[model samples]
Target chain A: MTDNGPCPLQRDAPGQVLSLWWASTGQETAMTTSGRTGDEQAARAERLPQRPVRPLHLQAGALALVLLGGTLGTAAREGLTLVVPEVGGFPIALSCINLVGALLLGVLLESLARRGPDTGPRRSLRLLLGTGLMGGFTSYSALSLATQQLLADGTVGRALAFALLSVVLGVLFAFAGVLLASRRRAGGAR
Target chain B: MSVAVFILLSLAGGVGAVARFVLDGLVRSRVSSAMPWGTILINISGSLLLGLVTGMLGAQLLTPELQLVLGAGFLGGYTTSSTASVETVRLLQQRRMVLALGNLLGTLVVGSAAATLGLVLGAAL
Candidate 1:
């Protein structure tokens, strides 16, 4: 039941046209080809107008926001440093934060995925808080900390294995999160 | 770290994330092939920058400000596993699991390997 009219998909920039050439028989040669010029011109080429003073505004806003987030993360770390002893002899307190964040993100994602996805608050929470904030906060820096500790204890093999496993498992757990979320939705649909 | 240093890191991170968003948007606007080249490119580039930063810092060529600019700012903006994961789920729901899996595993494998490479180069320096 599909008609053969050119599927008019909206281009990003206004006043742009896109027409795909499927037939070499010349039946649909009326569009896309530059009528006046023999050159097979590009189907679409229209630049979106740059916003006046947009870069300046964006630069300022971005600087402010990054400063806010970085300071918050850094201050939190500083406070934690005052509260807790050195983490695995690294003296960096945020190492613990990253580890704890990763674990919590994993667990929370699991629980939310179990709830069966219907685009609820839980799903959004898992997506935003668990995946975005937690994943962002938890750095590979912490994993290196643990690995360093293992090696420091004269367990080179353990350190190597830990290095390999933490990375491999981190990805696997992330994929597992996707699977769980999808399955939950499928279950609900059924 | 002083408040100034803290502000610098945050400022850098914000700019980085926004840059990532803009880059992805620019790419996606043209290529709707469902391949997500933007994510891949951003991540790989981020890893490389991270490597460069690590090497420089280890070599004493970079100060804390440079670290914040590149490590906390640029790489932070360049890489995004969370959005990639969420997008994968959305794709899976729409029965596009192959790309999803590729993205998930690809970022992890590549990102980790890149980090290790960076680490080695850093240590060497």
Candidate 2:
């Protein structure tokens, strides 16, 4: 995410990704105005130098939005866990939740970037949905605990496989989401 | 779970998310690495705490409902898998294979280690 003012950290590396959940929002402004090709814009947005640095500041409104979105996201995750029976204690529900969250976050961020600069409503939605909702919905700690439990239960193979597969699949799913959104943008432009 | 407990769990999740936001901001403000140190720290810490909570639950130090509120709600909200995954993909897209792999594998390995340590500590307690 981008910040409100120029952040020295934002200017650290040329293509460094900006903002985690708690950081400032709105750094991907270059892609929309560069007049570059769509693919280039997308690539640059993901890789090249970002827009001006913005200092990370605490915003009550953004925090509140994140809080609200997080409540909904946590409720949804809890509800799903209640219904999705564990498959032989493999935590299929958690894997599903994390994978789905990764994909949706990819889609949301890409679509929002393509739509416009990360400011105003775009920033708000990113904070609410991307940082708050998706961040709350997916869990790495639970995955770690589950893996540890499996190892403790003497299921070494299952433990390793579960962890490896989930991480690998999560990256793939996120990439798939980016492609899905990019394709849609292209189709719409044509 | 009772409706009150459920609502409390959800609110706890909200608070946890806010906590994550604040901590990440604090770390990001100080660190200027290409890697997302903020998220990496948050995940490791949250995993450790979750492991401790799980051990405590096993030892009957905490009730099941309280466990749910803290484990599934608080830690789950605080430690984010999506951000980690998306950040990895973004790094890979940029062809920073070393950093990408480091971010991916480092989190998994360190986070698991932290969880193990927490479990041990909790059980000892």
Candidate 3:
């Protein structure tokens, strides 16, 4: 690679260097492109694996998927809230939603992990379910608000119980989901 | 909520989730922390906004429709307990006890404070 003489563009932006590499090497280079900003570039370089830049169309498609999933998730949450009355200011509905969302998220992740790092459909599915649906369904703000109200109403015990229960149950349900997925996988294998 | 309100709520939720994704991605891309600063920031900010909305609603400065759109829809989607819980557990699993405790306790402490502050500001207005 050094025999090609000083690749001045190498020190230039990785994106620019990539274009130059294409011009010179006439083949796709393995070197990764840097992010648009310097800080992002450093962070990206540290965590992300070297890969070709994604096309704009693909990114837009993923965004659309996430939006659709989010809408459904939020609608479900609101619908539940409307039906479930808060007893003594305890947000039973919100806690149930969070636990269920965590469980589903765990299941999604476990199943996706089996397929490994993905492109196209699998990646899109991950974003739609994990980032959009579950994120929308399980709300931190509502939990915070409920807890705040409980405290304000002088029910510190209930508030503390609600907070601790939400965190503990959310994690436990997620772990249970993962275990369920793994058990199913094992059964399928047998 | 009416059908129209539900529709608006759904649309707002979509926007909020997209905002969360974009904002979280932006923060994660900039910060190199194992503590999940992105989720923590998003949760705290969302809590503050929700508090403001609640205060405004209590003051009767805003309609229920607006509250549904901005509060139950947008903030509800933007702030995620599931991610926070999962991330904290992940940190614990990785043996980063300090980070795990920080994420769990920090989010709750800051979120509550921010919400209360927003409520006060909203009520003042």
Candidate 4:
């Protein structure tokens, strides 16, 4: 149900569309149409999700640690090896990571679309684990490296333009995934 | 020790990431309107840092993995365009069209320039 009061996030300016992000009795926290109510406008702050059973939490932490260490360590070693001036200025290690991240993000999203949320908790877990952690690990480092390599190889226009576009559009695609996921979740809640 | 290196890099990455987070918070708090000074500042500064590191590494000056751990790993994570894009979407959803457009345009225009500048200056140094 849409509230008629002004949104808490908005200013006193009239007709200002103040969209309040609130988590209520119902899950998927409805984005209330902007308005305000007395004594009830502190913006819904959801408590952090409870960590799983102790064993699960430990497992998650362990997994996270391993993933973080492994990815970073490999990148560092790769970077060290690629520091030659003859190569691109930026380390090639990051290029490898970046490419991995981009490809994984694409694949994960595609897979999620197919799986299609068997449950809310399951869906959320997938997002938090698969998207946040995994997406973070994989990066456009490879593409960046390729761009640098191309530039070094005297393909200036292609390298610079491609690099610029990749950074620009890579960001847009990530945001798009977030948007698409949220919309899908919201639509399912209906 | 390899362990020492790991601890050091992780600590640096953590501090840099947190700093980026705090700056974003400050930006959001100060400018309720269209300006995303937080991200703009972070990205630009990060680019410069990358440039500085790149220049050194390119010159075979920086020690191995020093640039990777600090520059690529730390700074790359520190600077984010995804957050900016999401904030832009939030502005648009809240019907802040002008703000959204301004944020998008400003970040791209300013960010690229900053990165380019960083490369040039770092190379010079």
Using all chains and alpha carbons, the TM-scores for the candidates as numbered come to 0.50, 0.82, 0.80, 0.51
For model 4, report DockQ.
0.09
Residues B1-125, candidate 1, lDDT per residue (tens digit)?
Answer: 56676656545544455555556656776688776778677766677567667667878878967776567544653355445544555555668878867865676556656665665677576
How do these models rank on lDDT, best leading?
2, 3, 1, 4
Cα displacement (angstroms), candidate 2, residue A173, comes to 0.5
Cand. 1: chain B TM-score: 0.85
Task: Give the runs in model 1 whose Cα sits over 4 Å from its true position.
Answer: A1-190, B117-125
Better candidate number, 2 or 3, judged by DockQ: 2
Per-residue accuracy of model 2 over B1-125 as CA lDDT, tens digit each: 78888888888888888889889988888988889899999999999999998888888888989989999899989999999999998899889999999988899989988999899887778
List lDDT for all candidates, in order: 0.50, 0.83, 0.78, 0.48
Residue by residue across A1-190, what tens digits does model 4's lDDT show?
1133324344223212111111111333222334655334343432324423232212333233333433443344334444533333544444444434444454445345544543333333333334234433432223333444566678778666656665545445655655555555455455
lDDT of 3: 0.78
Evaluate model 1: give its TM-score: 0.50
Listed models, DockQ each: 0.14, 0.66, 0.59, 0.09
Say which candidate scores most in lDDT: 2
- Itemize residue pairs with steric clashes in candidate 2: A1-A19, A2-A24, A2-A25, A2-A26, A5-A54, A5-A55, A6-A53, A6-A54, A7-A53, A7-A54
**Model 3 RMSD to the real structure?**
11.6
User: In candidate 3, what are the lDDT values of residues A1-93, reduced to their tens digit?
Assistant: 233333556534443532452435223333334436678657766654566655422355556756877888899999998899887678789
- Clash-forming residue pairs, model 1: A66-B10, A66-B11, A67-B10, A67-B11
iRMSD (1 decimal) for each model:
5.6, 1.0, 2.1, 6.9
What interface RMSD does candidate 1 have? 5.6
Which segments of model 3 are wrong by more than 4 Å? A1-58, A186-190
Q: Give the per-residue Cα lDDT of candidate 2 at A100.
A: 99
